[model samples]
Target: MPAAIALARQLSDADNKGIRLDSASLTEPGTPAEAFAVQRETLALNGWLTAGYKVAIRPDGSSVSAPMAHITHASTSGTAGFDRPAVDALEVEICFVLGKDLAPRNTPYTRETLLDHVAAIYSGVEFLGHRLDDGSRSPALLFLADRLGNAGYVLGEELPAKVTEPGQTYPLTITINGDAVFEGPGKHPNNDPVAAFLLFANALTEPVAKGRIITTGSLCGAIPTPPRAAIAISGFTTLTVTAASTRED
Candidate 1:
C-alpha cells in the first residue's frame, strides 16, 4: 500500500482524535493519477460509501473530481454540523441530481447526451475540509488526494426547467447572517454546468446510478464562515446553511 493511502486512512478515521498532518508527514503523490488512486484506497480503508462526486475546474480547463461519502450529506434546513473546526471553508455551487443511469461508453459523451440523464438541478453549497494541517498551501496533487477538501454538501431548491437550459447564466447572491457578502452572475466554466457533469460521466468506466448527486465547482469561491453563521443564496433558487460547533457524539 502507498504511504499516502495509509496516512489518508488515519486522517479520515472517525474514531481517532482530530489529527492534523503537514505535507512533509503525508508525502504528496507523484502524479494526478497516483493521487486519485490514493483517494480510492482512502475511501476503502475508511469504509465510506460513494454518495456522489464534486468536480472542480482548473484555469487551463482540466477538471479534478472527488467522491463524496454518504456521511457528507448535510441537512437542507440551513444548518450543518461539523466534527472538525479547522476545516470550515464554504463554497456555493450548482448541483445536478441524476434521474437515470448513464452507462459507461467507449467514447466520450456529448453535452446533450449527458443532459438527458439529469432529473433536476439545484442550488447548493459544498463545505470544505481536509486532514492536512496546511491544506490551503497543499499542491494540486496532494489536495486531490485529500478529496479536494470536501467535507459535506447541502442541496437547495430545484431549479425551474427553463433556467436549466444549457448556456444560461443565473444571478447569484450570498448572504451570511442576513448580510449580503457576495453577489454576481454564476455559470460553469464550461459555459454549461451540465458539461462538467458530462466530463465526469465520460471519465467513469462504470455506470452512474440514478439519484446520484454531482456538485459543480464553486461560484463565489470558498468563503470563510463563523461557527454560528447562517448562509443564504438567492437567485435561481433560494438556499440556506447554518454552521454549528463540532459534535463529539
Candidate 2:
C-alpha cells in the first residue's frame, strides 16, 4: 500500500495548502481495491472522523465510496463546518440513517431486511469538491480515492413518510439565492434509492454502528453552485454555504 500512502500524502498536502493537483502528479491506483486503500490512508492522514458514507456504482458493477467526515444539520450549522476546498456543486439525495448495527456476516442483507434497519429518511445534499484540478478529467480511481469528490454532507428535515422500497421518485425544486436553478421530478441515478446502500452493506469489513448515515447517489446529478449561496430544496429545509476562501500565499 505504499502507493496508496504516497497518493494520500499528496492529496492531504494539496488540501492543506489550498491547491489543486495536476492529474499527472498522481500515482494512480490500478484497481478499485487499491483506490479504497488510498481512501483509508487519506482519511488517516487528514485525521478525519467517519460520520457517514457516500457511494455510487459504475456501469461495470464496480463501486466507489467515500467516508464522510463532516455531517451537519441544515437548520443549525448549514455548511459552516465544511472544511474542504471550494464548493463545486451540490447533489440532492436521500439519506438513510441507520437504527441498528450492521456487522460483517456470512449471509447477505436482503432489501427487506435492510429497510428495517433504517431509522429515518431525510432530504440531503452532498457538498462536492476535489483536490485535483477540475477533477472532471482525472482518473476515476483517483476521484474515488479523493472520497468521491465529497466535501461534506448537509442533513435537512426528516421526511413525513418513509421510503420502504427502492425506485421511488420525488418532486424536487432547488433554488439558489432565491432563484430557481432546477425544478423537476428527481430520481436516483441508478433508479433505485437503496442500490448504493445495498452495495455498501455487502462490502463492509467493519461494523457500521447505529446512527451512521448512508447517503445514496445523487437524485438529480450534480448542480453547479456558487459559494455562499442560499440553497432551498423543496420538501426540505434551506441551507446556506460558507464562502470558500483561498490562501493568498
Candidate 3:
C-alpha cells in the first residue's frame, strides 16, 4: 500500500474514535508535498469534503497551508457543529471569499490579479485542535499532514472592499463571556493577506472554486480558551459565537 494511504487510514481511525494517535508508530511524511498527499487521502477516507483552505507564514517567511473541512458563519446561531472547539487556543484572522476559480496554470498568478479574484473580506476566528498525542510537539511534517490542527472555523461579517488594501489594521478586542482577553491591534501577518493567499493558491495541484473561503494566519496569535465559553471578537466589525461545550476525556 502507498505510505500516504496507509497513514491516512490510521489518521481516519483516530479521528473517528475521538482519540489521539501514537505518532511514533505512524509513517512520517518526508516533505510538504508528501504531507499534503496524505492530507488528501485522509480527507477522502474520513468522508469529509474540502470546505476551504487556511494559509500561514513561518517566522522564516516561508508559507504552509491546509484544508478545512468544516466552516460556520457567525450569523448562524448555536454551537452544535463545533464538536472540537479550540481545546488548546483560538486565533483572530482575516478570511477571504473567492470570487473566481484559480485553476492550476503554467504561469504563476500575480498579486494584483489574485486580489481581483477576491469576492469579499471578513473577520473571523480559527479553532485549533489536533489528533496527535504529542499535540503541537509532533514532528513538523507529520503535523502538516494532519491538516495543521485545523478543527474548524467561524467567520464574522463582511468588510468593505477597501479594507483589503495593504497596511490596513484594525483596533480589535477579544472577550470570553464578556471578559476582555485580547485587546490591541488586529493585523494580518506581514500586513499582506493577498501575498499569503497567493502563495497557497499558486502552489495548489487542484483548482480552488469560486465562493470557497480562504483564511490567512492569525493576527492575535493563539490565546488559551475555555471550553464552551461565549467568544466575542470585535474590531472593524463584531462577531460572536459560543464554543462547543462537550469535551473528550
Candidate 4:
C-alpha cells in the first residue's frame, strides 16, 4: 500500500471520517517524484473513503497552462441550498458542470462526448479549511481522499451542463452580503473545463474505474468565510445569498 493511503487510513481512523488534502503540498514536494507519488496514493485512498472530483483553475486566471487541478466527490443540488448553514468553508467558488462522466485523458474531445453527465450547472461552494499541527493544510490528496471535500452542493434546475457549443459564454455573478465579489462572463475552465478536468483526471488514473467529480478551479478569488455569514451565486444573472452568525459560528 502507498504511504498516502496508509496515512489516510490512519487519519480517517483518527477522525472517524474521510480524508481531504490540499494543493500546496503538491506545489514543491521534498523528495524526488514525491509529489506525483503522493497524489496517486491519495487517489487510491479516496477510492476507499468516498467518491472523487476535480477542480481546474487558471492559476494565472488567464492562461490555460495555469495547471488544472482537482479535488474529490462531485455533488448535485438545487440553488436554494447554498450557504454556511449547509456546509463549512473559509471560501467558495462558482463553477460550471459538464453533463457527462468523462473518459480517460487523450480521449476524443467533442461537445457530444461531454454532455452525458447532463445535470444542470448551478453555483456550488467549496470550503477551504484551516491547517492542522502536522503542517497538513488540506493537501491535494486529502481533497481526493475526502471526495472534493464536498460540504454541500447547490444548483439550479434550469441550467444544464450539456453544452452544445464550447464557446458559449454564461453571465455569472457571485456576491456576499450584497457586495459583488465575482462578476464576469464564465468561460470554460480551459476552453473546455471538461477537457481541462480530464487532463488532471488522467494524472491520477486509479480512482475513476468507479467514478469521479471535477471542480475545475475557482474563476476568481476565494471568498473568505467568517462564519454565520451569507454567500450566494447565480448563473446568467448574479443571484445573491445572505448569512448571519452569532459571534461567528
Candidate 5:
C-alpha cells in the first residue's frame, strides 16, 4: 500500500475532530489504485454523512496533454474546516444536486430515467487539502484517498432545478476576494462537462438525493483562496459562498 493512504487515513482521523492533517508525512507515495482505495476506506472510517457523487476534471484549456481525466466518488470528506452555514472568509463554488442514485458503469440509462430521480439542484464549495504539493500522483487517485479532499459542502434551494442534458455546456466563473480568477465552460476543453458528469452519474447504482451537490472540479488547478477571500461560482443565477479561518469557539 502507498504511504499516502496510511498518512491520509491518519490525517483523515485527525481532521474529523476538526484537526488539520499534515502533508509532509506522505513521503512514500503509492500508485493511483492504492491511493484511491485508501480514500474510500478513510471516508467509511469517518462518516460519509450525506454526500456522494462526483464531477469530472477536464483538461485545463492551457494544458498540453489531454489526459483521459475525471473520477467519481462520494463527496464532502477530508480534514479541512470551513464555516458550516458559512465561514467569514470561505472559498465558494457552485455545486449541482443529483436527481437520483446512479447505476454502475456500463449500465444503460436514459435521460428520462435519469430525470425520474428528479430533485432540486444547487451549489456549494468543498475545501480539500491543497498546497501539499502532493501533485505528483494522478489527480484521480490523489483525490480518491484525500477523503475526496472535500470538506463542509453547502447547497442552494431545491426549487428551480437545472436538469442538464448529456452534452450541454456549463459556464463557470470563480472569483477570490471579488477578483475573477477562472472563467470558462466545458470540462473537456474538447468535450462537455455535463456529458462527463452524466457518464459517471449514470454508472452509480443509486440516485443522489434532493440536496447532494456536485462542485464539478476546479476550473483552475488548486490555488489557495485566503482569509476573507470570497469565491463565487457564477452559474445558474450565481451562488455566493465564502470561507475564512476562524478560532474554534
Candidate 6:
C-alpha cells in the first residue's frame, strides 16, 4: 500500500476501534501538500461523504480548510452523542448554509458572490478529536493529515442574516452539564465569518453542493468537556453529547 493510504488506514482503524495511534507508529507526510492528499485518501478509505468544510485562519493570516463528514450533524434535541475516545473538545462557531452550488472556475469567488449563495446563517459548535496519541505535539504536516483534529460538528439555530455582519460580536455563554464553562463575546477572527466562508469556497478544487454548511473557526478556543455533557450556548442554542464507553468484547 502507498504510505499515504497506509497512514489513512491506521488512523481510520484507530478511530473505529476507539483507540489512539501510537506516536511512534504514525507515518508522517513528506510535505504539507502530501498531508492534504493523505486526508483525502483517508476519507475515501472510510467511505465518508464530504458534507462541508471547517475553515480557520491562523494568527499569521494563513488559512486552513478541512472537509467535514455528513455524520457531523448533532440532534436538535439539544444533544450530541459520541462514543468514548471519539471527541476531545468543542468550539463555538458561525456556520453558513449554501443555497447554490459553487463549482470550480477560473474566476475566483468574492465575498459578495459567496454571500449571494448563502441561504442562512447559523450558530454552530465544532467537535475536535485526534487519532494519534501525541497529535497536539506532532509535526504540522502530520496534524494536517489528521484532518486538523476535527471529529464532528453540531449546528445550532438559524440566525438572521443581518447578525452575520462583519465585526458584530455576539454575547456567548457556554455551560457543560449545567455548569457555566465559557462566557464572553464571540466574533469572527477576521471580523467577517462570510469572508472566511468565501475563502474556503474559492480555495476548493471541487464543487460545493447546495445545502452544504461551512463553519468558520472557533469563537472561543476549544474547551474540554466530560463524557456525558450538556453544552448550552445561551441566547443562541444548546446541545448535548454522551460519549459512551467503548466495549472491548
Model 1: residues with Cα > 4 Å off, grouped in runs = 13-19, 59-61, 70-86, 164-167, 245-249
| TM-score of model 2 (CA atoms) | 0.89
TM-scores for the candidates = 0.84, 0.89, 0.89, 0.53, 0.59, 0.88
| Candidate 5 lDDT tens digits, 126-221 | 454331234224244454455444544545333244424334455667777778876665242223334445554554544445545554544345
lDDT of 4 by residue, 1-249 (tens): 355555444433322232222334433334424433444454454353323344554354321211112232223333332332223342333344544454565654444445454344534445543222222235443433433333433332344444424555556666666676667665544555455544444444333422333455444435565555456666653333343222222
Q: Tens digit of lDDT per residue, candidate 6, span 1-249?
A: 398888888877876775677777677888767887888888998888878788776556666777787444566566665554567778888898889997877888877777888888877787777777775677777878888877877666677888777888778888887888888787667788776677667767778899888888777788876656666677554555554434232
Scored by lDDT, model 4 comes in at 0.41
> Which residue ranges in model 3 land beyond 4 Å of their true spot?
58-62, 76-81, 85-87
**Candidate 4 wrongly placed segments (more than 4 Å):** 9-49, 57-111, 116-122, 130-153, 158-170, 185-191, 200-212, 235-249
Question: All candidates' lDDT scores?
Answer: 0.71, 0.76, 0.78, 0.41, 0.45, 0.74
lDDT of 2 by residue, 105-141 (tens): 7898888888778888877888876788857568888
Any idea what lDDT model 3 has? 0.78
lDDT (0-100) at residue 236 of candidate 2?
39
The model with the greatest lDDT is 3
| Residue 15 in model 6: lDDT | 69
The predicted structure with the larger TM-score, 3 or 4, is: 3
Where is the poorest 10-residue window by lDDT in model 2? 240-249
lDDT per residue for candidate 3 within 27-117, as digits (tens), equals: 8898888999988898998688888889877567677888888788876442323556235568888889989987887888888778888
Q: Clash number for model 4?
A: 36
Give the distance in Å from residue 228's predicted Cα in candidate 3 to where it truly belongs.
Answer: 1.5
- Tell me model 5's lDDT, rounded to 2 decimals: 0.45
